[model samples]
Target: MKYDFDYLIVGSGFGGSVSALRLAEKGYSVGVMEMGCRWETDTLPKTSWNIRRWMWKPWVGLRGFFNIRLFRHVMVLHGNAVGGGSITYANTLLVPKDSVWRDGSWSGLEDWESVMPGHFNTAKRMLGVTENRIMGPADILLKEAAEECGRGDSFYRTQVGVFFGDEGEVQGKRYPDPYFDGQGPERNSCIGCGGCMVGCRYNAKNSLDKNYLYLAERRGAQVFEETRVINIKPLNGGEGEQGYEVTTQSSRLFGGLLRKRRWRVRGVVVSASSLGTQELLFKLRDKGSLPNISDQLGRRVRTNAESLIGVRLPGDPEMDKGIAIGSGFYLDEHTHIEATRYPRGSDAIGFLLTALARGQPGYRRIFTWLRTLLKLLLTKPLLAAPLLLPFNMARQTLIFLCMQTLEGHIDLRYQRRWYWPFSKTLQSFGPKIPTFIPQANEFAFNMARRIGGLAGSVITEVLFDIPVTAHCMGGAAMGKTAEDGVIDSRGRVFGYQNLYVCDGAMLGANLGVNPSLTITALSEHTMSHIPPKQAA
Candidate 1:
């Protein structure tokens, strides 16, 4: 049967953009449904302080790229834009250890060690991956801290997806397309602005919109921005042999006059982030629109076992002058720590941080935090005032994003909350992810002490015993059968024809590093299984 498009991909992220580009290159007509605005360098926010254009709280009329979703167990930092999290994420891309293939539900499902390298190389080339070239104060601080802790050998520049034009050349210099032999957009060298997370106003960041999605559109893939997929039902008696009917509406909260639209697609790729894909699939299963979806839909969701710790130097340090996350080091075999930053004047995130408190979880941690605050107020009222405020946070503080390969997971359920009886939303359950990492906290404390500053942590960790993670991954993971996981090794959703998951939700293991590169490579792998349009 003829359909509106050969493939309809949800979310314009690392996964979705890769799928869109590869599928379009294979001669398939692709429709990319992105539930966010398309951002241009000129339109990007100057600082995260501009919440109206930097934060993504549609309920409150903020329609920016950065988003924070609070769950019972964790605070998830994600993004919403045409390029998804790449619009807000620090462009640190690193390959996970090979042992990841032997862990999690996807273990032994495929010869991942042998197969993933090629895809990684392809993703790297497309992403314009390179060793960070613009190290600034934060990188030096991280190296000093690593050396102070006697792990200096582990300190190294991160591999990132930023375009640095040339050695000794002026920064922000515009040039012809460098990665795709002029087939891609014109580029500019990074100017060491540390504004990647706020949105790269310099146009040096290799966001998907500048690469995969850009090339995909050039190849005739239609990207429908601000289009949110509300429902998807398989055609041909629910077997999806013919195609699927996808219903969508404007993503804007006040877009009531924008009537819902429907489209027919021969195949659907659910490339939304972990939370998004799981919530959508859960709603579909519960509503019986896609009842055949595996019961394991929301099981085994991982947060990359992450923790946020930092130091606030309070003055005279230009810490936020490099690329966001320019350097990192391993504290131990399992723990990886990266120096993270927002641009100068983007201090909004500091509202979530407070003086670091080291104690047990629950009431003990809260008590310790209270004591810390009390002591600071009593002894150093002047210093404590600015330290506690969000002002100068981006310029004066150094954030350590610590992640571990140690496995921990929470199950997401679509159910009504006690407070909100009107609707069932995605909620997290299971053993709580660790809110405190002793090594990371200790390192932060030592660094602060050495710099004559204050150590800090996410306030939620001390107040509510919940950690924050930007790298939320794994929900509809790969497994051997429908009973075991929601998708197969190749990302084909179990019990569904011509349906696939090609995002963080499909990641089965804790990567212990930024998952963008892995998600892109895995999406590439998933796309490889599909024959070209001629073969089909």
Candidate 2:
């Protein structure tokens, strides 16, 4: 049968980019449909204060990379761009503990311990992962806090995907393609600007566009930017045995007419993030576009059991002077904490922060917050005033991103909201995830007290009992059968031929650390199962 390409991949993220490159190398034509704009160093925003160029809220006319999605149980921070979350993520890449292979739906499905190390090594090498070379005030503060808490032994520099050049050489010096032997784009050494999240204007960050997606395009893969897939249906029909027809439309809200386009491909790879893949599959199943999709589509969605807590120092100490997350330490066997920061002048996120109030969830937390605020105002007005204000926030604040390996999950469903009855959308369902981590809060409080600063937390955590996480994963996990999960161990969607999901959605376990490396490794494993075009 004739088709537009050998395979059509949705979402040009860590998983999608890897699949594109490997498949193309195997002599397959590939098409990547990404619902985000392509970004370059010159076009990157100077600071997150440039809302239109830094945030991704298309409905409100703001279209950039970073995105925030609020759910009933958690606030999810993700990204939307050609390179996906890698453009905004901290670039901290660490391999999860081997115990993860024994947990979740994917347990016992494969010999993960024996197989994953090679893939992880390959992913690390491709991403240019190395020990962080620069450490600033924020890292020192983290180390001090860890020592104060008697956990200094766990403090260590993060392994990141940045080019630092020679240790003694000048920073920000341009160099020819270092990783790919001049086959890739030229890169500059990191200048320790702490602007990774705002987007790396220095070209030092190892974003997918500089690696996997770059190699894929060079291998004849076509990337269609700002193209959103709306529907997918198997052609000539019995569970995609023949080919598939994919329908897409412009992702811009007001770009032009709502014209739709179609593409036919022999296979399809849904590599959208966890939330995105679940939402799209739910809509397709409910609308009868691909009704054979497993009923376990949105089950077991994990958020890495994460929380956002921090400290706010009054005066400028140049806390935001290094990479976004340059160092971290383990508070205990299960919990991990990383010192996070933004570039100076990118203080918009401070509006969502307030004095950390430790108490029970719900009304009690609010009451405690009020009392804490009043006591600070009355006892130390000078310190309270500056800590509460949003000015100089990036320069004066230190964020603690805490995540746990402990298991917790929520289910996502496509349903109509009580307020909006006109149409149905993706909604979170299940027990509320923990909004407060007592140990993390206590550490923040002690750190603030010792440093003469103020403990802080996301305002939503205190007011609405909702925690925030940037590492949302799972939902569409791997399992042994169609009744148990949506996909198999190799990422092939159950009950469908030539269809796969190779993204965070396919991650069956909750990786305590960042999930980017795992996703890349798993995608590599998935691609290994496919034979080359000649063999086919």
Candidate 3:
């Protein structure tokens, strides 16, 4: 059937961006709907303190990119801009260990070790991947932490998606379409301001708009920013044999008064990140638009067993001047720790970091928090002062983003509660995940002691037994059958044709590293399976 476009992709992140470019290259007409506004280099927030332009609280008149969703089990940090999480993600992009493929729902489906490298290579080239260029005092301190822990050899520079030009100098020079041979946007050298997480105002970080989406737009793929898909139904009670109808609305203030727009498409791609995709699919399933969705829709949601800890070294010269994630060290085969930072004055996130404490789950954790706070105040008042008072914490702090490959997960569902009486809010339904990883806390303490600084962590971990995760994955996982999973091995939904889920939600295992590269490679593989659009 002839339709307005051959494909309609939801969310323009690592997955949707790649899908847009590749399917357009395959001669398919594509349209992408993103819920956030397009950000350009000149318009990005200079620091996290620019609250109106740096936070994603739309109800309060802030239409920023970064979003922080609170669940019973975790606080999920994600992005909502045109480039998705890439707008706020630290540029660190590392592949997980081989054992990651041997576990999870998709295990034994194929030899992923053999299948992923070529796609990864392609993704890396397109992203302009390179070794981290500026390793400042934070990296040196991490090396010292590794040495103190007797694992010095395991420390190394991170592989990232930032462009560090020739001789690693910030020449302020422009290179014409470095990755796509004149098809993509020009880029500049990184100035090492450690602002990748806050958004790259320098055009140095290789966000999706600079590469895949840039080329896709050039190839005639239309992108609708500040728009959200409200519903998707198979055409005339048939799945893809005819086509699909997609309905979208603007998310801007008073934009709801405008009529919702409807478009017909031959196929659909669900590339929203795990949380966003799951929430949208749950609504669709309940609304009876897609009744055949698998019951395993919200199971096995993984968070890399993550822990965010840090050591604040006050008066340390030039500590916040490096790349966002410059270096990392492995404490063991399962545990990885990276030195993370934000640019000076980007202290909006500093409120989330507190004194580290060991504790069990539940109310006991609150007591542990109080006790730890008392101890820090009594023993190290000078070090604890800024953590309690207002100061430039980002400039003086060395953050450790520690992740474990150990298998642990949670389930998310939509349900109504007393506070959310009007609508079903996202909630966690499962056993309590451990709030503290002793190995991670030990590493933080050691780093603090070695540097003569104060050890810190996320306050929620101590007070409420909830861990924070930036790399939320899984949910709409792939499996061998519909009874076992929501989608099939190639991201195709079990009960539908020409429909796919190709984002972090499709990841089956705890990657123990940032999952952006994996998501991109997997989406590349998913789109490679579809034949080019036939002539109308």
Candidate 4:
């Protein structure tokens, strides 16, 4: 019954980070394996133009548009790094509506809806969650727009994970353990560098290394970087089995490729985002690594009906250069828009908004996207980006994120030499979402019109009908029984013992908003079911 490790976690994002911290805190021997390496702020790819090196193609030598991969279900950005996805996530923390709990198959298990609050509160405290007291210029404008539209006071800043200063001089102030009780590392106030997504070169952003993973390592979990898990199989699973076996190989940071080497582990938790998790599990299933996996492996892969549209004013100065996601608006009950910014002149290829268009289930939506995208590609910068640039930000730029309530999903699979099981779902996986030009375009045009000194332009996206997904989920989802559920309420795989699937894959349904908070909370909840490794 002796196992190689108490827990072998694959992927080091929110789920893996939390699991490592908790298990290590409980005094279990944990082996955390990450497909990517450590990317500190300075090392992160800078500017949208240069970001492709790190974002599009992960690993040093790998090549291709696969680095910051886009897929049908979600846009897979941020790859192999010490902090996992936290390195590039916007750091906006939000809990799912109470409805998310009551709808999924896992709804019947105990009081998940009621119970999630405690976990949420606990997570918030650990992550230093707080509302933005000092609104960025972009957010300030959004609030004004909301008020003008008769929705005053409805505008509220997002509860970001960054630690701004007390006197609002966070612009250049540095503090030691400002949030933690002096046990954490020293931190500097955010300068609103507009680079959180590419990785915070400044220690201002609250990546896992700053807290969760930080504390976990201090407790004793070993995190292995640049290690891609190839497959996970049961060592001896049954009603009372003892351990699980995991295998992986070296992962290239670039070139958009993976070389299958060999390694092993006693237990495994798949925290490799949605696309990564789905592709890995599919290999386990199709390649026969873990055949007992449920037939519902790739169902309900959701896009959150997400869309991205920005309103910015280029060359106005003071543009972008602020917090990543400064403000969000509830355009209607189901639709929401956030005031987003990026360092001005970033990826200065010139197009402004990347508004998504959605249609009912199929190639029809793709058709709509093609027509709009062609216009975006052939258009001129003055012909495009400037119009989206808000008046105040016209010298710079303004961006809006247009997301909706429609629910769309996809599946991942495994194939041989040319199958692209990973490539198809991972590479070509450009956010295979819907198109909404008429509405989105109209909104963009009008917004530009309202605030302008001759604003005009268009929206665009990757050719061949691809989109981007930041918060990826599903591959293994929840269902009534082993027949459908990938794992039980405790997140343990239905038929396998000592094996569990955490990460976004466990997200049984859509949250219709940022899912980091929900994923972290679920991982925290799953920790309760993990029976302490019995005493020797």
* Candidate closer to the true structure by lDDT (higher is better), 2 or 3: 2
Q: For each candidate, C-alpha RMSD in Å? A: 1.1, 1.1, 1.4, 4.6
- Encode model 3's per-residue lDDT on 96-193: one tens digit a residue: 88888999998987789999999999989988888986888899888887888889999999999998777845555677667777777788888888
Q: Name the better of 3 and 4 by lDDT.
A: 3
Q: What is the lDDT of candidate 4?
A: 0.66
TM-score for all predictions? 0.98, 0.98, 0.97, 0.85
lDDT of 1 by residue, 1-536 (tens): 77899999999999999999999999999999998899999999898789999888776789899989999999999999999899999999999999999999999899999999999999999999999988799899889888988899999999999999989999989999999988999999999989999999988999999999999999999999988899999996666778899999887877734769989999999998998999999999988888999988999999889998888886659989999999999999999899999899999998998999878889787888889989988987776778789999999888899999998899999999999999999999999888989988888888888887888999899888999999989889999999889999999988889999999999998989899999999999999999989865
Which candidate do you rate higher for TM-score, 1 or 4?
1
lDDT of each: 0.91, 0.92, 0.88, 0.66
Superposed by TM-score, candidate 4 places the C-alpha of residue 195 at a distance from the truth, in angstroms, of: 1.6
TM-score, predicted candidate 4 vs. hidden true structure: 0.85
Arrange candidates, best lDDT first: 2, 1, 3, 4
- Stretches of candidate 3 above 4 Å error? none
The reply for model 4, stretches above 4 Å from the true place, is 51-53, 56-66, 72-78, 168-170, 236-240, 253-266, 312-314, 348-395, 415-432, 437-441, 453-466
lDDT of 4 by residue, 1-536 (tens): 56667788988888899899888877689988886767655666565556444443444454212245544344554455776778767788877678777765567765887788998997888788888655667777777777766665656688888878766363757788876698888888887767666577778888888988888888889988877777676665432154656666766653225456434455677788777777787777766667888877766676666656555453554646577887777766666767766654454323433423434435565576555545654664463443433333322556666565555666655443364434433333324565342455455556665675222222324233444556667767766687767888778887777677778888877687788888888888888667676676
CA RMSD (A), model 2: 1.1
